[model samples]
Target: MRMRLLVVGLLVAFMALTGCAKNQMSTEPGTQAGENAAVATDSQNSNGLSEQDLADQQRQAMAAAEQEITQNRIYFGFDKFDLDAEAKDVLKTKAEALKAHSEWKMLIEGHCDNRGTEEYNLALGERRARAAYEFLVMLGVPSSNLKIVSFGEERPAVDADNEAAWAKNRRDEFKLFK
Candidate 1:
């Protein structure tokens, strides 16, 4: 009786595994009933994005990610909120991208190095963030799509006391929201 029960259990397990395999195989592209089953002909998929529209969105997202990784910051001089020529150029490119994607919104965060009093750094960070925000607005990016905040000296990009670390910490960072 034990032998018979063991055989039955093995058979049930085998059947269960085969059932799962069959379900997986049926969903594969070539295993569908018709060759055209893999093709999406509707202008809009169930998610409401057409194939072209989905592709476009993917490209935009990739571009935005690359920009954020490489150039989404405008560095500032110590105790200064003014945009240098290079900072202005960076903002121009960012503004153009913002214009291209009207559905996207941006948060500009102002940060400062750990050289000043907490209260003073906080106020200076706000000024730096506001400068970037105003520059983007002047470059034709919609004012409604931009928001600003100040981190002051609380969140340092680098913790060292050297000039290089201080320079890295004093900047405005851009974050994207949809």
Candidate 2:
């Protein structure tokens, strides 16, 4: 009777090991069972979004937001922090975009031409960035969603010492954050 019990136990162990091995070996890619497993994993979770689906949506949203920020910039006048008509128009468009996508946060960088002293340029840049920030807030963009930074004359948009280069350097740039 003891011998029969030992034999039955061995048989059960062998069957269990074989079943596990079969499952592991059958999970290779390109197999129909593997494809089905992937589909099962993509089914809606408790949050109603599959892991893969949610990741794709996040990637697309980030790309669109980055593009929007990159496409819009406001230029400043020589040694001036005021927003001209053209700058106001650009800000209006940017404000509308920001309103539509409330999840985005931005950094407004103030820059200056290489004409002023370092200390003076830094102050000017700060004022320029602050002007942009205030204008955006007035246009209905939440002040909490924006930050201001002054690069001064350290980073020039164009390195040439010509008027065109100076014009490009005196600008406010927009950058996106989480």
Candidate 3:
């Protein structure tokens, strides 16, 4: 009778550890979540996942979101509305990314050097901003996802009256919206 009891206990232990039963199909004979993947779909076959699968999918999604956020910065040139070849290259890359992430939105901030009148600079800045906006729209970024604002000569990047300062001040900056 003692031998029979021991044998029964061993069998129960084996079944529990191996995740094996006549009604279930467990390829790995273990319940280490991902380990016995075969039995996973069975529990959720009608509805889905054992919690672990859902978490993994969420993790992958978050990783992709982070990667997209990392790649989304844009730069511009000095007092220029038209995209130079270099700026176009960069914009192409940005446009492709933005197109891929259709849900993303952007704000384009147009700036100018302090040499001009505030009113004149504001108009110039608007022109510059619109140039970028138009180009981005042409490249497949939806018009609705883009907003343009002109800072005029109000925000001087260098805060100095020099060629270097003017060059740095006149630029279009890109900001992403979550």
Candidate number with the higher TM-score (1 or 2): 1
Best-matching candidate per lDDT:
2
Clashes of each: 0, 0, 1
Flag regions of model 3 displaced more than 4 Å: 1-79
Between prediction 2 and prediction 3, the one with superior TM-score is 2
TM-score of structure candidate 1: 0.65
lDDT tens per residue, model 2, 86-151: 899988877887887899898999999999899999999999999999999999999999999999
Candidate order by TM-score, decreasing, is: 1, 2, 3
- lDDT agreement with native, every candidate: 0.86, 0.88, 0.76
- Give per-residue lDDT, candidate 3, residue 41: 57
**What tens digits encode model 1's per-residue C-alpha lDDT throughout 135-178?**
99988889999999999999999999999999999999988866
Winner of 1 and 2 under lDDT: 2
Total clashes in model 2, counting residue pairs 3 or more apart in sequence or in different chains: 0
Cα shift from native, residue 160, model 2 (Å): 1.3
